[model samples]
Target: MNAPPYLSIVGWARNDGYTPNYAKRLEHSIGFLVRQLDRHRIPSEVIVVEWNPPPGSPLLADQMNGFLGGTSHASVRFIVVPPQFHRGPRGWQKRGMHVNNAANVGFRRARGRFVTPKALDTFYSDKLVSTIGRLDLDDRRVYRCDRLDARMEAESWLDLADDELLAALARHVVLRNGRLTHSIDWKMRDLHTNACGDFILMSTPRWHEIRGYQKDPTVLCLDSDSIALHAAAAHGASEVHWQEECIYKVVHGNTHAQRVATIWKDWQLKLDHYLILRHRRELAMNLRVWLNYPRRRVRGLEEILAPSIERHFVAKAARYAKNDTSLVTNDADWGLARESLSDRTVVRAAWDTP
Candidate 1:
């Protein structure tokens, strides 16, 4: 009998071209990942969640036939999340993608001992893959690594050998860990919370213990990943930052932050910045009294005063300054464990039965 997989890699995406050449990037990311795992002989499973797939577009799973060739060490599966679960409970209603909810769909179904939520366009370094392949990961620790942003045009190197691509892209390191390279006046260089959603690894059990990223769609698309890190720490999971291993993020034009930056003008940025400065002060006091604001009002404020403020201040404060010991955010039904969803085995390992 085949033993359970050593690790489960989970990521969520739609077929819509959200970023430039997104399909190509997704192909490289998953294909390279599968090849690397096979190179190291690691028994693993890759789960890609096709969350709220568009009406007239091809599903991501339909495009995986080309990615799974010559794959032996890892099995790949794709879960389809229907549109009903997209907006989430309490009528949150704002939707492009609910990262946490989509992730939960994969997390609840993962069959591996260890699980990590990754970005669709991310690539795992050889060093990182080798480390995980050893299966020496600790269930009591939450593993994190810094993200290196590469140039958008680096897609030309997609077919290059892994080491060649890695070496070629090393020069494009715009951000190392939390430090923004080639920046003269960016003061937000030291915060490790930057791009954290790209890679977060923890044991499957530990993920369940914390209930998989506060499924609150109300928070919108801001620092929920960082909050999950805090939740992990709160539940006594020690953080293990990988010093030598990091994930590579292919930078594109239409990311959430980049879009926000382009939309907000110089004056708007100044106004939002000032408002965030004040919001942080109020947040500190609110944390004391356990002050709570209506979700409607908060979302309205987010619309007016730059949602980036939630990422920078509100989440940072809740993660570091909060004194509560809440473990999981969703109810007992976290990850929609009870839902009957479509699960397709896109690529099975050679040892597995047809």
Candidate 2:
């Protein structure tokens, strides 16, 4: 009998207008993985789910051809999905443009015993492959990410060479032993201040038990990560492993990590700032899911009605977006920082184990 694949790494991305940059970073990310997996003869699989092309943007396949060609220890696959699957109210899709639904789609197709779901902006360290290979698999423990910090934001990732990017990260990224770092912002310019990455790793069985990631429309990027973390904790996971710095993240203008409100450069930019209200809804949605998950699981009464609740805030966000339009052109409000919520509350791990 054939041995099963050891690990599966899954991520999805779509860049309708900026496919080249996304494509380059993707190639770099995968190639980095291949370098480690191939030499060690690790049986691994990489699945990229590409979806939703803007009006004239080429299909993700056309933009990413030939990048997957390799005869090695790991197999690479590309999947094209319809955008309708990701569409949400107020034209909101998954938090990261593609979130739980996209990753879950890849999970359903994965063939490895161990699996990792990562953000598209994530770049794995060479040691990560071997780390996963050596991890003592515990059904109750899920692995979380360690980030190396550097706020090396580029207008286009293609602007810097791989070597240059590596040099920049080496100058920063904090790595420590037997310590867990939570939510380190890699986009920070201070090398020592920010050094970390966020990624999730676990056994396929544990993932299946948790029913994969929550696709609640209100869960934003941060909430999505939290939901998975809490789900693991709530499901009787003894503890989670936190690895040393081995993942690098890049902050591009378009990625979720870099989407704070800013001034419009000109009239065209003001008109194109259409995603303002849409993005703000992420704040509302995240709060709803975080607060309600426990109530729904514990009380079983009314089930934390989300649709009507989401509609209630949708109107508020719409008005906020309209208010933002005035600032887009005016100098006064253009630079005002966007505060997602005033009293940011914590979303804890609350899943009850049977």
Candidate 3:
């Protein structure tokens, strides 16, 4: 049998066209990745988790095959998390992508020594790929890098030369030196949580030990990525910020942009509200301790008083954001490991190169 690959690249997307020319962006990013892996001779496998796919639309697997003209030198797998698993917490209606959950699905099934979860619309620099290819990364560290936002038209992306593309990407550095000043609460100490879901690399074993991302279904879509990073830190994985390497993200979706803008706009109001909630939660915990409440009563009170807060709330709390203790939120069956999902080997090389 063939050995497990050196790296596993996992990401999730559906064909809802969340961004204009979403398919084209996926094609460009995935094509770039395959080419880079082959050029570096990096033994890597790519896993694209098509989570909660829209019905009646063509499958992303088939679309990706068509994107590469049904061929690629590097190994690629398309794992489908069918519509049935799209339901939200407590029977809440299915909303947009369950970003963390989908990532967990791909991470669980990844067969590589080192696993990196990324977005389909982001392209990795050759330097970054080469660094990973060297395979000298320390297993005890979690690697992160800044995301440079490049506003490249999806359809026009394929026409750019490598030199022109990299030059254009260098002009827009969204998160510099691991700082997104306005993205998180000012009271909270900053860590490299900016566009983290786009590129978070660690050993496959470390990822499993952290139990993937927080599985809470109600945590706002934007905050979960940072929560995962905080959880990693809590699990005693040292942070290694890649100042030299960058992941260029193609700016297209308004969801993330708008969310950040809204937060920044109402920053003070949200901070006050979060403070109020935190006080109540702390009061309840103290009351429980003072009264020596029964375990069941304590749990009930805890559930009532301490609701889950946003990413910034975690940033302010050391229990989850620092090394006091390990934080493994998910159970042993994380990433829907028990489910019998469809895993397809979608693209196999039919040509020399793209």
Candidate 4:
């Protein structure tokens, strides 16, 4: 019933071995959030839609449960829902769409004009925070930024001072130099763009208009970064003239100087392969057309793929209509039913992790 915030930063996390320095990284992220609260300027809030916090791991809920418990200025606000077992599309368990599913949970609670769905294992700068909270950014365009990746060791990160984090954020690690870059590097990859989870700053209504994240039982898609690209494309969106300001990212794994190469290499290759390669020219053409000058509405991927999916459904219907009695027909019928409704329980983002 209170006033809305300027921005609502949404993300998720789980305490598994897969994430390195999660406590520290998340602690830094929370600290960054606290420092960026500009009441007269950029009033903001943090929404953490946590799904599977492992035992012994720190919950943002417990950290910021004091005065501003349900508000944005709190250490964090949560929509701590349990994970549903419906991992079908793009191997649901690994594609991060589940975390995105968690994002939808927090998104429902957002009263801010803008929301940047991201991951918790990363830390960012105050500049990046302000940039994301822009109250006047065009709703017609999806925003993205390049992130600088780094790593650290485990310690009581919650105690670190902001000065140390500021110094660390200024540092960068690129594969070309094998050390921190002498200058900043944050640009969209040429004509073919690949926005990451942290890169996007979408308007709340735009997020809703796009209908959250895309899903299919068989597709490798929807990380926080690429969702905007695909959604914009599906809606006949603007070309990718993304911001060029560098954003810092904590890698959250091994601090082994030697492992730095492999760690950053894997990440770079991930961006290159997924955002650049894969569909090659087809995706490039699609993105280029959408991203082109004087951008106007055009046929989006939804238009192209909807019929394909419908054709599939129609074909299956014909089979069933033809008295086909097989697992394929039964499974198709079941899949259609499942997609129409929400399975997991829904709750307000202001709720605690119960």
| Model 3 worst lDDT window (10 residues) | 293-302
lDDT (10s digit) by residue, model 4, range 281-352: 444333323333112111211211222211222233233333343412112222122232322212223222
Rank by TM-score, highest first.
1, 3, 2, 4
In candidate 3 the C-alpha lDDT for residue 342 amounts to 90
Q: On residues 140-165, what C-alpha lDDT tens digit does candidate 3 reach at each position? A: 88899987777654456556766567
**How much does candidate 3 score in TM-score?**
0.78
Please, what is the whole-model Cα lDDT of each candidate in the order they appear?
A: 0.71, 0.50, 0.69, 0.47
What does candidate 1's lDDT look like per residue over 1-354, in tens digits?
267888889999988787777887788888888889899988888999898888898888897765668678788888998877775443344444677788888988998889888897888888989899887989898888888887746557777877877786677777676622422222222334566787778888878877887756453545567776767666667777788888987777655565443233555456546755876644433432242221222323246332344443344435443435543466778777999989888888865455
Off by over 4 Å in 1: 87-94, 179-192, 260-323, 350-354
* Winner by lDDT between candidate 3 and candidate 2: 3
Which of the two, 1 or 4, has more lDDT?
1
* Best model number under lDDT: 1
lDDT string for model 2 (136-188, tens) is: 56666666656654455454444555556566766655433224343221111
Judge candidate 4 at residue 253 and give its lDDT. Answer: 33
Q: For model 4, where is the 10-residue window of minimal lDDT?
A: 176-185
User: Number of the top candidate by TM-score?
Assistant: 1
Estimated TM-score for each candidate: 0.80, 0.61, 0.78, 0.57
Which runs of model 3 end up more than 4 angstroms from their true locations? Answer: 66-73, 90-94, 161-163, 171-177, 180-190, 253-255, 260-317, 348-354
Task: Give me the overall lDDT of model 1.
Answer: 0.71
What C-alpha lDDT does candidate 4 achieve relative to the native structure? 0.47
